[model samples]
Target chain A: MIAPFKTSYLQDMALTKTPLAKASYAGLLIALAAIPLVTGEFYVGELGGLFIFAIAGVGLMLLTGYTGLVSLGHAAFLGIGAYAHAIMLAQGVPFLVSLPLAGLITAAFGIAIGVPTLRMSGLYLAISTLAFGSIIGTVLQKWDKLTGGFDGFPVRPPTILGMKVQGAIGTYYTSLIVLVLVIWVALNILRAPLGRAMVAIRDSEISAQSMGINLAVTKSIAFGISAGITGLAGGLYAHYVRHLAPDSFDILLSIQLVTIVFIGGLGSMHGAIFGAVFMRLLPQAIAMVRDDLPFGLGRTPGLEPSLFGLILVLVIMFEPGGINGRWVKLKHWCKAFPLHRRAASRRQKSYAKSERLR
Target chain B: MESLVGLLQLVINGAATGCIYGLIALGFVLIYKATEMVNFAQGEIMMLGGFAAYTFVGKFGMNYWVGSGLAILATAAFGYLLDAVVLRRVIGQPQFAVVMLTLGLAFIFRAGAGIAWGYDSVAFVTPFTNSIVKFGSGVVLGADNLSIIFGTLVLCGVLYLFFSRTRLGIAMQASSQNQLAAYYMGIPVRRVFSLIWAISAGVAAVAAILLVPVQMVDVNSGIVGFKAFAAAVLGGFGSIPGALVGGVVVGVVEQLAGFYLPTGFQEVTSNIVLLAVLILRPQGLFGQVIRKRV
Candidate 1:
């Protein structure tokens, strides 16, 4: 809770506000890098999956959390990216060239979907995006010549400089590096004026427009950037799985991405990571404990989805700000510790009067 | 001559299925009118209703019509309970939260149905036998399809009368228009919302009853609800008659596309129509253009 004083302009704009914060981040990075060394192959693969989801989560956080656009079709963009990369790789293109090209192709699709949709807001936008996603899924299935239809197609392992990245270890390290690069880029974007504009638009589109922010361009760019990042994650996922299917990128996946973004805490960088890790690891944790339950619940085929839905509902109801919000609150509480006041612990309720009027 | 007969048969089949979609779309429209939140669980509720009816008839050996009526009542009660227990807590939250909650509810409903129904398609017994009715020039209609269309018409007429002539329905309408004013004017807004949810679920149950005879009831039956959602959107989300019209259009289009177009386009035809409508005429055919106040 103690405010850090910045002595210089350089200090003010630094990634971490204090030396302690910087050290913690460095320590966290070291721990992440050391994960594969300590964990078994299965755990390492799960961590890789976690990183891939985190990357996509960050992209969605940009659009939904910061840009205030709720899209239910993000998985479609991911599918597009996955398909694009698979096709490019099939055509004898190298991994390096195909990856970024996949991102660009997905970004173009994002812009194409966004330009017409940017005018609509809230429920309308959500429905349109849902429709858009369904269409992508349909196209992926029907366009069998390109997508291989329902049976799906296998993806070749990504190779760099004539060396193939093999097994969970290589995939984990590659994903970690990609995740770091993505986080760095995202942080830079968040610190820039573009990020501020997105936040402004989220707060009040009318006010943002009145302040000379180009609503159309800013919204489209946000979609493009978000989709591009998500597409990159999709490409990584496809390469990691070595297989692709239309069903893998369905509405359920889109909902899962949204859940991660919300559960991680909206509009925060660390929140996205927290959410991805929580969501990805949750099913495994549930599976581990399923057999030990008192009831005969272990035999149930759909317990995981039921539990997930219950958790989502509970999180939204009790902690709207998600894990990041809870973490900040805990941090504040610990800082106040013995001298903690009830007033200080009370959470702020942000109910808008306008919503009631509408 | 055979192709023309096949086309007529497809249209007839499409119209029958469209009636079910229209009925489910009515559920979406009613809830949206009452609470501005799109209940993604609407489809799941229909699926659950179908399963409930299936259990009543298939397991218990109850008469078809009696089982369906009981199922409708039970589902309505479930809907009321859902509103009271879960949705009531998150009433004032953002639209996204509400929508997500409904989606979560959907997941729960789907999972619950899967657990209860064992993830298998079950035959739903109807009062009418599956006798084929031959018409002019070899154009044929199944008895179940005829019943589906007739059932839809009866449900529509009843709903129309209830909404137009009843005091409770008038109050519900008042609450939808302006909740605060309705509350101020001595209307029980909370109860009205609960009733709306109940009615929506009941309508969905009817749709399920009608649909079950044609297609076997299964866990994946909820998938059809998305097409119903598309129909609702195409009809201008909150419009009652629009839902019916949109449902028919979507159903016909889907049938035509599945028969005429390359394989798999049928599954996505509604979504394609929905997207086109959203982009070209977001207000829908019957919906008024919504203006945001800065």
Candidate 2:
């Protein structure tokens, strides 16, 4: 992965360091594009769900991973976006317009929630977000006229350029396009000075402030952008699913999104994609092998959740760096094959470890 | 006079429910005091305890008291094992990771309970039958409500005595204040940590037992833990007495909101109070203000 010496500043600041990396990335994009054509209808739908989750995962990574803000209310924002998009579409608004508008509305809500809670950090902030999420959930259930109450409401499939985006393939492409655009935006943000500011704040708010970074502005902006991105994903999800229920975006979904970020590898943009794909495919994999297993374990009501919980615990205990961390290590080890030094191939300390009790 | 009586009834019911919240909040405070880690699984632990008691009394045909006692002991053992096996390894990990781990554990516990005891809601049998006791001109209290209030009071008093007068409790407090220093002084810090988890789990079991008698036992009963969490935060996360006061406050506010406001406000009332307290007064009523240091 090491790159040749760059003669110019532009070359040094390039997204991909080497031509091999660039070619591989291009190949990945083409492979992703061809997935809908080659895969079955069922898999196309799964990929749609994957892309939606990836969008949300990337959003969460920006806040929790880079900005060091833990939010248990992400699903609430998603709920807001889903409802907003649905409402707008019902009113004859275009899909493209409704998507960004839903994002903007969710961003406003995010800022409103963030402004009050951002002053606090760690567990307190997490609890506050949890409270906010529950409150939003309650609102979604009670506001019957707007949200259709517990029964939920129908979401009309989105149309593009006067043609209906029909079926699983259509939705998959729409989600894929959105996912690609979001990834691009996210990558650019990370490369920018603002991303560095966020990382600095995450590392040490006090030191970041001493360095003249506005804590309030940076944190609030992060919250808004994160919520906006998650909201867009929600908009996409609503159209894809063609239905909306308050229960669909509960605290469990929020937990799942966070799990995606963590299992993929926190603070890495690519981790979101890897985590989302793995998590989305996991239940399907289980379902495929469920009948073969002895004792009918897969038929249990909470089996999937229990498995997810076990995975989360295992990941945190053994691989705090997650799947991406393992990938990086594997690459390093492979590069130094035959003389691979475990110590030398270890990942740099990027994440903040908790302080031991005095 | 009838309206006044209705209000009093609501207040009484609120207090009873609040006591249950206080019991759960007390678990949060105990663990936080010892380790500064919020056990997100506290509610799920409560739910499992209730299921355990149900299985003992209903399925095994055991006496109510015996079943309750067994449930508490079992949950305590589970808690100890949880801390010793899983949580001990995560001692110096980030707060976010620990919190998420507890959340994951909560999911596992809830799912396990659901699988073991079907998702159906079953009436929990208590020794005392449901009876209404009239007081003064119009105030009437359910026997169950009175028992819950009194039981919580007794538990709190016992806990207070344990922390103040017992040797092991004092040792736990010493370890919580300074683990390394306590270790230097020959206290078993790791053992203390496990004991705290056990005590917290046991308290959660008591809350669940009391709760199941009032309503019914179901897999989703752990949702009450979220309200208790709010109560813990509202009262001051690490303060024992604050948990009680906070629980009462949240319960009363929730009942009043449900009574006076539009329908469905009750569900969100505790969260609203939680958010308000967290934003307006992060230190809480009893919590000491934490000053930031460079």
Give the best candidate by lDDT: 2
Residue-level lDDT for A328 in candidate 2 = 77
- Give one digit per residue, the lDDT tens place, for model 1 in B146-235: 888898889889988888899998999999988889999999999999999999999999888888768888887888888887789889
Candidate 2: fnat, from 0 to 1?
0.64
- Sorted into a CAPRI-style docking class, model 2 comes out as medium
After TM-score superposition, what is the CA distance of residue A109 in candidate 2 from its true location, in Å?
Answer: 0.8
**Model 1 lDDT per residue over A79-143, tens place:** 99999998998899998899899999999999898888687656766777788899998889888
**Colliding pairs, model 2:** none
lDDT at position B293, candidate 2 = 57
Off by over 4 Å in 1: A1-14, A342-358, B1-3, B134-137, B292-294
TM-score for all models, in order of appearance: 0.94, 0.94
Superpose all Cα atoms of candidate 1 onto the true structure and report the RMSD in Å to 1 decimal.
2.6
